[model samples]
Target: MSSPSANASEVLIVSARNGPIAKLTRDEAEQLFLGRRTTLSDGTPVALIDLPAGPVRDRFYLLLTGKNPIQTRAYWSRQVFTGRAQPPREAPSAEQAGNWIATTPGAIGYLPADHADSRLQALLPLR
Candidate 1:
């Protein structure tokens, strides 16, 4: 039988090959996505890319930030209206997100595990 963690769905946080980031803890990822952190561990400026609203997007935010979709939208709206931060760039699908992360310097995005590949470096796994 599989363990709970083994069975749990996971979203892979990925970056471009040769990007300054190596890996991120879940808390660090949360901070980045929440606009609380803007750079990678090596002090490289990074951009956040998000998958369009759907199961993978939902699961990634819920598991990493403990925020549901509605709450997340509200949070970003407040930040944007206050001129504090902009929401992440969004890709229309997992494939697009993966491709963006793979080719863009300092770009980071989450994808369902099966879409992860050598083109991108997996930084964190959020369940």
Candidate 2:
């Protein structure tokens, strides 16, 4: 059997400085990330990190696009190849991803719930 998944999933919404103070519903996160619409009221692209390929990502996959992370990578790669938009930065782990997003401007990434720190905001509670 596959290994247990990460600690938790937290969807954080970031702003210029002080945000993701606002929490997000699972559905809202679904639209933002998988939609890749980049035209939300805040007008920033949603960012997702390299989550382990397992049940946690699976649940998110179903919630978002009904596709796996690999599929999402392919979709973003195609977009990048065509110069339409850029894919979200890929981090090795949740902490690394959080560090990147927390420092970068106009960035939003999902991190495992317990891992959420002052650097990153927690959006949704673990179920």
Candidate 3:
């Protein structure tokens, strides 16, 4: 298990590899995570993965989009209802998300900073 303070403090937006994507601004990170942007700046299509619901997920949205979990859920619901976009695929745990990010090309996901490793490239750090 992880500590609440640690989970709340930092989130790392990561990709499968470095160089392919060096970094992203907060706005770009938010857009990509929210399904508003389907590709990276270099035109590479990305698949967004999400951690299962918890403090980390809640903090991620709050920091990135200024929305709480409920608001974020409603936003995605509206998008799906209107046929605009789909929410990110959910990973059961940070380790699983890391594994997916490591193997899937153009994959992106957020994990507690403590969980980050060489398998993925850190693209953005959200508080």
Candidate 4:
């Protein structure tokens, strides 16, 4: 699964020695990956992020939520106005997203599965 950013890279998760990262079930991952507010197995909050709206974001949204980006945004907005947690932060690009996850403590985001590069701590197998 080599990609542009990670031509010869291995993504190894770097997490706390005493505990696990917030791995999620597929269903849960779908929810978070699609910009729905989701929690990890340990009940930690998961923030789903994507580049502002584009082809890849559209595809990811559809794959994860079975809906288009516009619909996802509408749904996310409703969740926010209703006092639920905010939708995932919108990073401008893969570079911005990587930077955000790299620096933001207790936060997590994803990139191309192959290019994840262990930049952010990888969650365990979702159970």
Candidate 5:
């Protein structure tokens, strides 16, 4: 089936090639990105990186949460205002996001599929 996003951009959940995780479920991914999760099923801790505000970032959240950027922003605002959680650390660009994933141990993030490379391992694809 097609994704709920308007564009349905191909995005991949990724970690450093040698990172502890090998894969993740959609529910697991959602929880992690939303800051409600920090460890994988195997108990390996993870950090989340994010692409700066743009089409790719918007598309990623839309595919993951079925929420547009505005809605997602509001959700995060509330999360922060209430001190419940913090959003992921955003990189200046996709390249930077990928680099952070590659060098930062246990760092996990989403990238446009075409931007991922050998240094990273695909954990899941949000189609």
Candidate 6:
């Protein structure tokens, strides 16, 4: 029953427990999520995962990029049409996104605070 305007203050950007990334600034996270950057400042390639098109996904994009779901869709459409980049792989839900991030090396994704657990290393708090 989430909505695009759901309170996202509890969202967290996360990675695998052993991921090379220890932390990320909001600018770096925004760049990575928007497909503007592929590697961390230290050059570790990032495998970004995203939640499927939904309230959580929309809320994340809105908070991270200040773009609504429709705007984000258009942005990605252009990126794809221009061959600039593909959007991150989509997970079925926040819990699944967290699971993937925890098990995949160099993987990063955002999840609701409750879903983030010991398997994942939280890099940044969206709020």
lDDT of each: 0.80, 0.54, 0.81, 0.56, 0.84, 0.81
- RMSD value for candidate 6: 4.6
Candidate number achieving the greatest lDDT relative to the actual structure: 5
TM-score of 1: 0.88
- Model 3, runs deviating above 4 Å: 1-8
In candidate 6, how many Å is residue 56 off? 1.0
Lowest lDDT sum, 10 consecutive residues, model 6, at 1-10
True lDDT of residue 98, candidate 6: 79
Clashing residue pairs in candidate 5, if any?
Answer: none
In model 4, what are the clashing residue pairs, if there are any? none
Judged by lDDT relative to the true structure, which candidate is superior, 3 or 4? 3
TM-score of each: 0.88, 0.58, 0.87, 0.65, 0.89, 0.88
True lDDT of residue 9, candidate 6: 57
In candidate 1, clashing pairs total 0
User: Which regions of candidate 5 deviate over 4 angstroms?
Assistant: 1-8
Per-residue accuracy of model 4 over 1-127 as CA lDDT, tens digit each = 2333442223322222223344545576665554455666677755455556676566556655677878877877787888775677888886687676666654555555454544455542211
Evaluation by TM-score, superior candidate among 4 and 5: 5
- Tens digits of per-residue lDDT, candidate 3, 7-118, equal 5378888887653556677777888877788887778777889999999999989989999999999998998789888788899998999898888777888888898877
Model 6 spans with C-alpha error above 4 angstroms: 1-9
Alpha-carbon RMSD, each predicted model: 3.4, 6.1, 3.7, 5.6, 4.4, 4.6
Per-residue lDDT tens digits for candidate 5, residues 1-127, read 1223413368988989877777788888888877687787778888889999998899899999899999999988988788888779889989999899999988999887778888998887877
TM-score of structure candidate 5: 0.89
lDDT of 2 by residue, 5-57 (tens): 32545323332236432445566565556544554456544454545556555
lDDT of 1: 0.80
Residue-level lDDT tens digits of model 1 in 16-104:
87777777777778888988778866687888999998888888888888999999889888988988887889998878888888888
